[model samples]
Target: MQPNSVSPASEKQHIVIVGGGMTGGLLAVLLAEQGLTVTVLDGAPAPVMPTGPAQLRVSTLTEASHWLLQNSGVWEYLDMSRVQPYDAMQVWDQDGTGEVLFRAREVGAQSLGWLLENGHLAAALYRRAADYPNLHWRCGVAVEGARREEGRWQVRAGDEQWQADLLVGADGARSRVRDWAGISGGARDSGHHALVATIATALPHNACARQVFMESGPLALLPLYSDPQQGEQRQCSIVWSGWPERIARLREAAPADFAAELQAATGEALGEVTLLSERAVFPIQERHASSYVAAGLALVGDAAHVIHPLAGQGVNLGLLDAAVLAEEVERATQSGRSCADSAALARYQRRRRGENLLMQNAMRGFQQLFGQRALPVRWLRNTGMRWVNQAGPLKRLFASQAMGRGADLPVRARPRA
Candidate 1:
């Protein structure tokens, strides 16, 4: 159904999702397109299209996420000019002489992933959803409470009571919906904070993403397009992680001082760095809900799991959650089962929970391994990195994983033939 052909609110199968960010927004569109009515309740107002250098809040979208968007018909609505695609990734240890390089060519792909502004993606999803005949969006509506009654969810927000056959909590790390559903999520701080910003560099990024692992933590420089007004393409987004005290000092440092530190930290790989946007700092932690589904309720995105941003796989995981959950919901509905059918929801959980857990553990282990100051441990890890870099078959496998092609894929997430 086109937006013009929307069924009356009372006549459609209603699914209400809290938090209309990227994952929730994409899930809303997917569900609505499958003939279920989806209402997205978001605390924040809708996002506007990006007009300049991307804001600090950006996501590194895996190739699978990009393909999912394209297959879902949301890609066309994006401001393509603002999207930055990188086909190569370089990871090196700053404390030792070890590095691993991944390239799309090894995986028979054009690009590994893209650096997308979160707002740009939200704007695109919103614009495309405007025509979803079954989608009902309410931005700036705070969900104050949620409960299950008579097997349906009743969400209270701003003097209004919204009921739905199924409810989704995509409300971010601290999700009210997850709380209402009694989901158990534990957060373990990495004792690090991430300082993110957009910056101008004396040298162009050359469409490559790079990360340098220092004792402080991993610092990533993702390529970004330059503002037309700047007359040069020497800008990039940086995510530098470290202890609170260290990040605080860096964040409070003079712009030039911080820029010099950035250049030094990255070995001046991109030459001189200049701040183009104010650096934003946030705590680094791993949070995962014990379960992703409960009768009539489900969780997606950060509300479900959040790993360290060292690999920038956070958004990619969330997009996959959206794809897989949507697939399960559609399958259930088509089988004459409730959208919240326990069996179907269990299937979704079974498929995603282990994979997410594996990634989380991997990140934690990687962090621990890198943080080890022991000479033997450092030598072993450096040797491992070097070995991984030179092993042709292993490099190909790593490239596929980075491209979002190694794991079990959803239909929409698979690249088109």
Candidate 2:
């Protein structure tokens, strides 16, 4: 198919976003809500409810993200029955005696955050976008190539061509749109792999999220909804980060043997862990683009940066990126200016880039600090955790930051009364 004819530059901004997953769909819906024409292209189909068991791919979304979803009309569409809220977090050092605890009530919040399948959010974002007239979703196709023509962006996908005054890359870590914009960055390898799976614990999860710093890396047992297949609610999602050699052993181990190792790793916190799903492993790495914007293009979410999963801040940060970009775009459109104008894009980068870098660095720092099995490093982290836990003000400040409320938030992401 021939490329679609390009729109005149003088016309209102027509935006085309690549990668229609969580971030792309979100940015599309938001721009459409601002009355801008948005076309989303992805090689994948829209998300729908799974037919069998709960999925292993999940994210921990903060209150700020929840607020943005609510305003975008996505949160209300989520299947709450599949959602689980954690009011508490228990983090401890495995090789040491240091441990710290956090609770939402200390921060005057009902629950800290939630754990939901990635597909659940994708489905919600897609369903919410369906109600908007300005959102033109073109799924099961990809942006073959993108180029700037006549001060606008034009992309080729198979036989079809879609042109827009502005373009965005939400295509994730290996973003083709970002490459098209000539953005490059060096990726840092954490030298670890994350193994994810669903398991039924010998004891109830008790609605608490737990993590333990082992010699290998950090292990998180995020509370998840019960399994519909089992007719019981005792399952939890676990993410264990470790070196490739160790991860391979677990991945190849027998199910029963893997369960025993997992239980031993957690110090038997939730009792024996019985694996309920096949363990999946992914290499962990940190990536950030040198710049988030080009002349007629911008990047958001994993396209711009990918952080360590230590704090589970990866998705929340991406959602914030979408919110800030939408806010900046709305500001420009209201002033009768191009939404992809240099000034507006710069504002978005300025607001989001610094925060993302901070989180990325923090995760790296913890990884390095905890990667050591030395007596001194272990002692230091444990002591620090003890102090942070014992000091009321310090603990509150950390909790607020973890909740994504310590800094100024985009109005679209602020919670409603």
Candidate 3:
């Protein structure tokens, strides 16, 4: 059978992406830069730069993610003053004496990773995407339906409609694009909920990210930059994962009572802590699509898979998906094939699905391992942590993975020559 092909003398291939969040927005900019006609349909309003106290939702950006933004011209649009770069990370068991410390200097890097408000990063990507003449970013437009028609995808939103050679599902976990394409995937409850908020510590975080694993779950204190005018760096973002009931109670607890619990959890490591923002709670679930691509469509970000947030690699994984898919499309286009070439899409799926699943299972294993209450298991884990900390090579290997360094990185994520 003859494959669908773009006319040699006519217009370039057209792609309609059904989401304008971080992943979808970045993909639009990438495909548009490759001379493809791209249109993004998002149900939410455009994101605005965040101000005032830090937002409850944030993401840790690794070096690979940083390079992606820098190479795509999106980094310049961000407000550097609002971004916090942490040079170190500390992980320990609250039930034992085992602890591991990772420093950027040990890896010859300036910082382990950066923390950015989700709103801030989204707005920056939106701003950079607006610069492309071939990209049409439409916010507040709900996607009513999507279907394959005569070798093309037709997307509808109310009275408007668009036809394209490719469709992308970056609509998040409950993605409408995935459903419209009839993709098979299900969510598995992790039997836990996470309480998130911004906090003011009595002592500064000292640009270090810390996590303590307890019987219930883990609590991560990720450093956030203080308001420049305040001249203090005591602000941090906290993600407390535990039983659903516990998270619910924490969410409803009085401010003083909550602060008291936090202080106890950290054992005064950061001194007295106070809540600086409203608390938000969300259930943790593990999700993975049986396949990431089908026909003329592809899934990216949470739409493809969702994992436990223990390692703060959720957004980083999504960004890598967008980059890899973009690279595959560009490769096919350069080789005189259609943008939705099956071989190209298969390569993308093969490259990303295994890695994402590996990370997902690894996080689940960590969660179960720490959740064990057996005395012997506790001693073994604690001992293992101490040994890894003392072993420089193993520690560096872990740090490199945390920094998103690997041989299979997409071109945009690779360091420049």
TM-score of 2: 0.96
Please, what are the lDDT tens digits per residue for candidate 1 over residues 254-282?
A: 99999999989999998977898888999
Number of backbone clashes in candidate 1:
0
RMSD to the native, candidate 2? 3.2
Give the Cα error of residue 41 in candidate 2, in Å. Answer: 0.4
lDDT of 2 by residue, 191-225 (tens): 99999999988788878899998888999999998
lDDT measured at residue 286 in model 1 versus the true structure, 0 to 100: 86
Overall local distance difference test of candidate 2:
0.86
TM accuracy, model 3: 0.96
> Runs in model 3 with CA error above 4 Å?
1-13, 229-231
Question: Which candidate model has the greater TM-score, 2 or 3?
Answer: 3
**Per-residue alpha-carbon lDDT of candidate 3 for residues 217-245, written as tens digits (9 for 90 to 100):** 99999999877644477899999999999
- Give Cα-based local distance difference scores for all models: 0.86, 0.86, 0.90
Work out how many backbone clashes candidate 2 has.
1
Error of 3 at 197 (Å): 0.3
- lDDT of candidate 2 at residue 3, scale 0 to 100: 16
